[model samples]
Target: MPRLMLTDEHWSKLRTILLEDRVYDKPEHRQTMEGILYRMRVGCPWQDLPDTFGLWNTIFRRFLLWTRKGILQRLFKKLISEPDFEWIFIDGSIVKAHQHSAGASSKYDEAIGKSKGGNTSKIHLAVDSYGLPIEFTITGGQPHDSKAAKPLIDMLPYANYIIADKGYDSEAIREQVRGRNSIPNIPRKSNSKVGNDDIDWCLYKYRHLVENTFEKLKKYRAIATRYDKLKANYESMVALACIMCWLPM
Candidate 1:
């Protein structure tokens, strides 16, 4: 038997969500989900998935339907109905895209862009105090952090602090965070007249929690490197990985 990624407990929780979403009622639901996980864990082409999980084309079709309907990300957002909001961290990570990631039909270039690192995409992510994902946005590799920071800052519930790095040290972001009743704990750039004197070094250090979340999610090679030609599909894979992270909680 091939090794499986989801534990019994993980399947139990996920199955409930899938049922509530009314995606499928077949007995093979567990195998189907496992098939997708297997593809992600091994970072293999969909055609190359092992047979123990059933025909890979069938599983890929199911996954396609889920992404088309936004079920994957909807499930992720559902899991965060309650979270520790003492400190909210927002950051972006660049994921290298395979040459195959290009050539989507979208006029917007499908969130893929050419950066200094060559073809790439960026995941603008926010995590809660405990380093669990809260919400995220996908953008071309070169969009500035502040460009994505507004919606994320506006999404969180009122918290003691919303933290980020110097890259997010714009006045507009600070004002927006304060508008949501949370203090911005970002550090100033080196040349700024308003230095980081008021910054809480203790809390700022914890921004690693967001980086840690990225580290954990990237363990799935499919996530570490972009393979899906469509941005929506790639984002679904990332959402599934985030769900896996929440499963252990």
Candidate 2:
């Protein structure tokens, strides 16, 4: 399938902003930075990054630094102001951590040791029905889906509808979502419901967009196999992946 491409104006704006933040310190820095962005945009591996990207190690290090500083997240927020946002979808997925990415001190709340996947990290992401990601939260594989739902949900305000899975069916969550004037579209758990609640199966089918969003995100090899020793870096890559998904054709 053909991939989406960034426009000249988009490139110019990104180059200007990223360069201001010391992204253009070296002759090869611009190329390296663009290379990594291209790799993220195309879901390619670092080693496989085309020769045009210059030294992969340099690009990777800069990416790590940007990740630590939360640059990618800020960049995504700036870039997504043009998206359609009447409805949002929330969901979570697990990314198996490569052994190399292991040894991160268990001190990291988002760094959970092996459970079902043997050293895997979990990602909770919220996206629009168009599969444009809004926000993400990283945690250990063992963390309950409900654990990060609150924080992830809090990132978005004034959403018309917030859709989630049955796992998020809780009185507290429902009440909290109500505060934003957004109704929860999640089906009530079989054991938890008292009476009939309207659920539109047709609209419910839209939840698959979030699922497909996860599917496309894992296409990045580094993302599919978590290698960032820091949770922030891993999550930054998730944001970069989201940017790729939101790229205009």
Candidate 3:
């Protein structure tokens, strides 16, 4: 078989969650998962998958079923049940969407939009103190960072301080953060009446952690540029990437 991404220990942790109530061969399940990971890592078309992982169509269909069931998202949530919430960092990044990512059925928004960069999608992430991603939301690239701030903040697990850059410098965002009883460490815009005195310059330095998280996430070619026509599929790709980050911790 092609080199596997998950070691025995890692597979042990995931098998229960991934295989629950599934009536397939356990060993084949691992191979199917590794095949999916290979596609995500290499950003290859499903038809390009190697023979060792079984029929490409089977693996691709399983991925679609899992995405529809939210299995990957649930697994990520389960792994992050116990998180370090002292300092939460939030940020958004734009990913250029490949031409193939367009032309999806219109049942749901694909989260792709036309921008200066051509078709694009924005991923808004919330990371914990250790720079581990806890939650994220996908939007059209045209939306401002402040537009996603409230929803991202709302998903956070009880953080002591929420750190962000000036893009999230709106009073409404700060008030929302304050409403959650978390201190807002976002820097105020220069012309704003609010002074930077209340800002925690020290903790603000750690805001780079979220940027770093984005860097690591974008390392996966599939994530660097959108390939899936469906937003749910792309979101599952991201959830899997986030879970991989936690696996080593």
* Candidate 3: regions farther than 4 A off: 19-25
Q: How accurate is candidate 1 locally (lDDT)?
A: 0.88
- lDDT order, best first, reads 3, 1, 2
lDDT of 3 at 143: 93
TM-scores of the models, in the given order?
0.95, 0.84, 0.96
lDDT of 2 at 196: 27
Candidate 2 off by > 4 Å = 1-10, 19-27, 37-52, 105-107
Worst 10 residues of 2 by lDDT: 1-10
Summed backbone clashes in each candidate are 0, 1, 0
For residues 157-231, write the lDDT of model 1, one tens digit per residue.
788999999999899999889888789999999999988888999999999999999998899999888988898
Q: Model 2, residue 8: displacement in angstroms?
A: 5.3
**Candidate 1, poorest ten consecutive residues by summed lDDT:** 100-109
lDDT of 2: 0.75
Model 2 C-alpha lDDT per residue in residues 8-113, reported as the tens digit of each score: 6656666666766656546565565577766665555567667666677778888878887878877777667565567788988988887767676767465755
